[model samples]
Target: MDSVKLGLKENWKQFALLVIVNGFVGGMVGMERSIFPQFAEVEFGVASKTAILAFITAFGISKAVANYYTGKLANKFGRRTLLLFGWLLAIPVPFMLIYAPSWTFVIIANILLGLSQGLTWSSTVVMKIDLVGEKDRGFAMGLNEFAGYFAVGIVAFITGYVANSYGITPYPFYIGVFLSIVGFLLTLFWVKDTRDFVKKEGKNNKTVELKNVFLETTFKNKTLSSVTQAGLINNLNDGMIWGLLPMVLFSLNFDNENIGIITAIYPAVWGIGQLFTGKMSDHYSKKGMLFWGMLMQGIAILFIPYSSEFAVLAGLSAILGLGTALVYPTFLATIAQATSPQQRAESIGTFRLWRDLGYAFGAIISGVTADIFGVEYAILTIASLTIMSSLIIKFRMPVNIKTVRK
Candidate 1:
């Protein structure tokens, strides 16, 4: 216990490993990012957008549920235990995707994928925070997110290329198989638990404990609730993009390669931009960052439907990604700041539960809206909601948030 010094430098080796592990985590999701909805339309004879997007709805709900439990059980069962189990559970996902006989199988695969991600990704996040302690907390989160999202971009592009060259089904999902194996091996052999570090940090920590972390993070605590809502909306819009944007690009008559490129643009910029934006969170105002970042996302999403020009669409995608980068790291940091160290995992889990549920909410909202209206109107709808989310942050979040731990 005495040997476990907290801070990034103190545990760079383990920290770096976790970052790599998270990259694999991101890659698992990236497998279907560019092609999944299209895959549904092409392979399954599934016509309704809502039916096509059922996979996402399933993924989001299952992942959201897993996230809350991971946080609740992290300390009890051990972070490393959850991490390893996540990777183990993930091993069958790609194989399922590869041989899926029906859309039912695809939906089942995503349910498993979501559970693994909630456990693995959430574990890595909590572990990184534990290892880094306070001073470079934001920066550490930046690197962690950068790895995950950058991998998402990379793998999404690769899978897109594979889908373009080969077919969409089995080949692209092979990436998932490889990623799952490597991720599992790495965690099984190398990843260490950080519960001790959490205990170490908790001893000196003095952030105010909420009467009920789940309730407060969900909607009770002013600053935290504000950030939580923003996070949910952030993912909500992101879910819209994930489920609909590729289809929009397809409607524009873009080739699969080009669709991949355009689709990859947002997450690539998002992932890389966080390399800096994460550090910026340490020095900047969380409220300002959250407000403006979300506003940019709303504005960029609005422009997406208006543009058919390839370059213009790509530019808007970049803007959307940049907006996400601004708030993504800041969201976690602000949550950490507001909660007691003893309860950090639970609060984060609760926040993530709401945040990831946006995927389901986004899929349903955008899917139904697109079916009733048009794709353009659906984009407009989510854009308006995103802007509304930003306003909540602006008006609801305190200027000088009382988060300085005692």
Candidate 2:
């Protein structure tokens, strides 16, 4: 007799725990979101956009590598081991950030942060897919991302306020210390490996196996490749927002507290909107959702530099968030549906590799462009690329078929 169960309720305990762990994972990243770009300039005396965005570059490169390996290794070593190791890398990140002597040290800290995020976040994503099986993968991914990013919004907002009150260095990073320790303890004691669940799910999934998963997920296969490019551009715009948004807000005369609030609004809306959109993937056409989501995002980003008023900026931020929410979880769900369970983790990891590399590309492209052509052109340029991405998905990708466990 084979043992396999699908649906969120059956695995709620483990599902919920993974969600909690991922929240901490997200919080770890969020700690820097609102503060770091400006911190690089003001405290460290870094002036160039390229130099200021160096941390994001390091993080994207390292995390992309980690994401690729975590997928390859999750099955061999077990998800629990990767999760713990990720936290171990995180242990030193806060201290390094808090006590850094110069900008070089900060860049090193972000590299470690990248390692932690890749390992822990990837492990949690694979684990949740394992637990929920196939029927509710969209909802599962949505909830998972919601937990992580909502924490990101909350932490970003809090750290901003903390920086405003007590100065940017040392104080704002204290939350990282707390998150790392708590996340480690929880994973060590509560998280369980779900590799068996994946095997069980695979037995039920009758999809054709992927040959050369790396090639298929990357470019050889049309649908997988299409999804891959869209994911990359999605994060590319995100990377732009991470490094440019605060600078834009600051230029408009917003204080740290206001910057934080405005920044928080984007992820907050992104995190919250997924509750419905995730499930929508289950019932609607994946291609249609991806098309419109990217469209909305491109339009929102194009208009960001035009709005200097705080209220208008905040509303635009929320619209950007909505666009992201529509597609973020759908990316994972589409990959999960496209490949056999045997290849799902690897494919997902490969997708994430390109997706996260967007952070680096986005940062570099936007940063250097802003340096040369002004920030508005940088914004306009990425927006045009985003629209191109949407067109690619619309014309190239096949409709993703919905599936469920036996």
Candidate lDDT values, in order = 0.91, 0.91
Off by over 4 Å in 1: 404-406
Report the number of clashing residue pairs per model. Answer: 0, 0
lDDT of 1 by residue, 150-195 (tens): 8998998999999999998789999998999999999989998999
Position 348, candidate 1: lDDT:
92
If scored against the real structure, what TM-score would every candidate get? 0.99, 0.97
**136-197 per-residue lDDT for model 2 (tens digits):** 98999999999988999999999999999999988999999999999999999999898889
Runs in model 2 lying further than 4 Å from the true structure: 1-4, 400-406
Candidate 2, poorest ten consecutive residues by summed lDDT: 397-406
